[model samples]
Target: MEKKVTLPKHKFHIQAGDTVVVIGGNSKGLRGVVKEVIVEKDRARVEGVAMITKHMKPTASNPQGSLVKTEGSVHISNLMVIDPATGEPTRTGRKVNEKGKLQRFSKKTGNFIPDAYRKQ
Candidate 1:
């Protein structure tokens, strides 16, 4: 048998809990926090952004089927990270920060982008 090789993992531009704006699709111009990132599909689920309805079958909890509402996945390319400093959507870039570690920064304003999840 031949040896199998694995490719490098993809680095997502966005992560969980990052505030983002939907630049396209039905939720265009809407802002929400990133709930989760679906790396396999390059999609991100944003809270209060892509509202989808699902028809559920009857279960022990209920005799009749019910409709479930939840956030839907949006393509990563359609989402833009909001710059905390500028309060505007801006492209992100990775650069070495003061701690000598790679950090995401706002390309438009040259400011370090703080990790929204680290504070808490």
Candidate 2:
């Protein structure tokens, strides 16, 4: 029998509820909150970017068949995390804080993001 080994999922600096800006694609320059992050696929679903329309038949939820609008997953490479301190898009880095806790910080301005801004 052959044994299969699974690789660990990729880690991302972006997290849910983080404010992000689309740097490329049709939604370029648009800002939205991170609804979900797919670490394995390196994609994220933003609140208002990459809108797509889907046609669905009538179901229990929808009495009538209609077009539903939704946001599609955006590639991580095309998205940039917005720095709360600078109000600009910047790369993120992880560091150990003075209390010996892992914290996310902006590489651009070297500002550490407070816990209040991150989603628990």
Candidate 2 has a TM-score of: 0.84
Model 1: which residue pairs collide?
A: none
Most accurate candidate by TM-score = 1
Instruction: Write the residue-wise lDDT of candidate 2 on 59-88 in tens digits.
Output: 899888899899999999998889998899
Q: How many clashes (backbone N, Cα, C below 3 Å) per candidate?
A: 0, 0
lDDT of 2 at 3: 92
The best candidate in terms of lDDT:
1
Q: Model 2: residues >4 Å from true position, as ranges? A: 1-4, 60-63, 115-120
What TM-score against the true fold does each predicted structure earn?
A: 0.90, 0.84
TM-score of 1: 0.90
